[model samples]
Target: MVAAYRFKPVVVVLLLALLLLASLLSLALGPVAIPLDDTLRVLLQRMTAAELPADQVLIIEQIRMPRTLMGLLVGATLALTGAAMQGLFRNPLADPGLIGVSSGAALGAALVIVLGGTLLAQLPTAVLPYVTVMGAFLGGVATTWLVYRLGQSVQGTSVASMLLAGIAIAAISGAVIGLLSYLADDAMLRTLTFWNMGTLGGASYERVAVLALCCALVWWRLPRQASALNALLLGESEARHLGVDVERVKRELVLLTALGVGACVAVAGLIGFVGLVVPHLVRLLLGADHRRVLPASMLLGAGLLLLADVVARLVVSPAELPIGIITAVLGAPFFLALLLRAQRRGGV
Candidate 1:
């Protein structure tokens, strides 16, 4: 809104280029370094059912590739959700995680980690593969619905009330998580503690497939609301006058955001900053149009997180820092600086 980014469509292409650059760099620069050309060769060989050096194939096909792919999907999900939320709320400060979705999803995952095999022992084996993901999705959707319902007053929807309700739900979920933590054994506690920071080290083909589905679901649904979001930017009455169906749009946006974020959180633990930062960066680079914002957010977010994952791997050599830490270190200061600038202009 403050300024137009020059040549919008080209910028989206450049973002895709950046994501490709990050992917190649990520595939090459791990603890066990593989040359970029060799990485490409290995990838091609795998695709064509050709043979390669066993060691090179093992590292690329088994380890780094899945992690990189998961990073792309999870990052895209968070950033897309954030962009959608900002569009819905008509504020740059709006992040998907600002609502209770991430916390609710985290709580659901914690429940599975703590009690799944024992307390949920009777659950069908076929359902176990997806139980955790389904739990997270349902939790997030339920929380979003509750917050939206609470925010609706006789006159209209209240952004303040929505934010406040989100805070309340987050607080309650945190308390429940604390209780779960108390009940967990050492093993469960260790697993639960991993949720404190996001990591993609556990990435697998199955997870990559699952997150791809979630990303596909999100990618399919979000851009459809671009026009409605643009209308809502003019305020609820104006959106209604423009035939935007404000309530339905809001419901659809919130649920879709929940679905995407919940699935990513379930798979990736709880990466932050992608949702909070990437969409803002996209808007600053590509303008406020939701159509441009959503897809651009996906590319930039994937690139940023892949870059972060590379740093996470290299920062400590043999030991890796959590991806969340890298993102927090990067994001926290950016957020503070943005806040300071906004205050100077009295936009806060």
Candidate 2:
């Protein structure tokens, strides 16, 4: 454990390096395959207000830049929330979706897809795209609020109750999504399918700005709870004995997780596994310290998502794969391996 503590800084540095490399690769590699030097030049020119090839500048600034930024923000938010949820629940396998946020967001997108043609037709054409995003964001927030309320009692919020409530909510949301899918026409079904599968294709500066604000809020606030989280790991009674306000910490963590993960699911759709996988990997490398887990999860999560997006882009050339599929393909096997190892070690 002391060795893990000593190595934490080194792990952080390595994750940062990986994030930087992933960012560069995300910018340079795509269907057009811009050179690394050219990508750097374009970024520099954007700040310096200098001239560059209009086409190259247009592609980088208008498309890939926003996508890459969105990936980083979404990845960081998911992983950060996942770590917080695990700490709050005192369960290593807990993820942000354990609160039903992702399923709720999916249900929201499904609603918009199935009904938007008629119900939203009166809205201006330019306003249509945002309807789905807003639907998703609101849906996630609403569901999380419901779950929180269900978990409340005279004593305080119960983490076990919350976990069970989340599971129930997720199941209901899944059924609703299925019903919506059944009601959708072929085109609507296709759109809904893609949205559920996840994509960064809709990324724009506008969407990125909203998600960045959410990410910033979460990042700014969550680390402050690191000590409380560390304490809580010893159990709620012990955390209270140590002078931590367990209830307040739980409230803050839930609220922040909802905001961050809601915004991410709103923008990117149901990209899973980052929340479930990244934090566990960070803990494995750096010990079960929330202080080490949180920031390291953010860095590693951003790098992992960026790399996954890269593979999604290249796997089929001009035709892209859903990034959710890429993450699941990469994450699921690793997760199963973890389960197997835990069982072998009698840790499960």
Highest-lDDT candidate: 2
Off by over 4 Å in 1: 1-5, 46-52, 119-127
Q: Write the per-residue lDDT of candidate 2 for residues 94-164, one digit (tens) a residue.
A: 68676788888777777876876687778875666567667877788788889889988887667778878
Off by over 4 Å in 2: 46-52, 116-119, 124-134, 145-168, 185-187, 342-348
lDDT of 1 by residue, 1-348 (tens): 444565776787889899999999888887888888888888665444455567877888789889999999988889989888878877676676777888888888887878674856687754553677877888788888888889889988877788788889989988998999999989888777777588988788887887788779789989888889889889999999998888788888888888898888788877876788898888788788888888888899999999999999999988999998999899888878876886898875
After the best TM-score superposition of candidate 1, give how far the Cα of residue 127 lies from its true spot, in angstroms: 4.7
lDDT, residue 27, model 2: 90
Give per-candidate clash totals.
Answer: 0, 0
Clash list (residue pairs), candidate 2? none
Q: Candidate 2's C-alpha lDDT?
A: 0.85
* For model 1, the run of ten residues with the poorest summed lDDT: 44-53
